[model samples]
Target: MIEKKITLVPIGDIDDSLLEYISQSIKTTFNLNTHLIPCQDLIGCVPEPVFGGRYNSTTLLKQFHECLPGKIFKLVAITDLDLYSPIFSCFFGEAQLGGCCALISLHRLGQEYYGLVEDKALFLSRCEKEVIHEISHLFGLLHCSDNNCIMYPSNNIIDTDVKSSSFCPSCNSLIERALV
Candidate 1:
């Protein structure tokens, strides 16, 4: 498999602190070099309005491809803007299953979204789980059966909480073999 640098593309007013935290987590989780590129610099990838106050992730993915760096650097877009796919009611994120270029949204990850007290700790935890999950897909790892695994599919914030930020042993082996 061709391994590449991971790039985090910031979209739509994402906080710098959170992006920094995500960058650190990406390094720690994948043991790979990561870079950041502000979406303000990427032309033609502007967010498009869609149904129910959501942005289309599929379109954003296409934009990611348009500016895809040479040699498959495995770019993932990070945004606070709410995202939705045609197939789902909404998405915390969407990624190519074993392909390059993924996206994640911080919209529904916060307690504030559910009309509860804001919690940075909880928000950050959920964010890391998501970043790891999408990046795992970029690495060609499938949804894991083990609920505790980071690769396990999460349908909602609760499921994201239930899964550990670390990949399970099975996934660890796969990542090692796949990336190392």
Candidate 2:
């Protein structure tokens, strides 16, 4: 049987360190090997932003499915662009629930985005949380009620900062079962 692994695709000029941190975090969280693809020129290829410079995340997920390799067990695309869905005005990320493709954007995660001082540690923490949250959805997990859980939906940076990067007990069990 072919060994399935999680793949990380950088949508544009994403920083290497951010990708590396996310790749390592996913490997540790899911106990699965991770493959980081080279930066892709998706900014120009994807549809232009509709309004307020936000790209529709659902559309991007479809593009991700078309462009990403099929052999991987899961695919997560990281971008610095802002993202949104029809249901929400703007969000940190979006995933294909119970599906293999997920996408995350760092546009709003950074403190600098809000005109505050840059905090690298805080920014990375938010990124990790969002990455794990989106990937968990790919594994058939839902928005957990436990606010501390990684599977919890983060409506804003405060919610993201409040949640831990690890899964809560109940969510962890579900993840284990899904892995089987």
RMSD of each: 2.1, 2.0
| Residue-level lDDT for 3 in candidate 1 | 62
Which 10-residue window of candidate 2 scores lowest in summed lDDT?
38-47
Record all residue pairs in model 2 with backbone atoms less than 3 Å apart, i.e. clashing.
Answer: none
> TM-score for each prediction?
0.91, 0.92
| Candidate 1 vs. true structure, TM-score | 0.91
* Model 2: CA > 4 A from native: 39-44, 88-90
Local distance difference test, per candidate?
0.84, 0.83
In the range 93-115, model 1's lDDT, one tens digit per residue, is: 88887788899999999999999
What lDDT is reached at residue 64 by model 1?
78
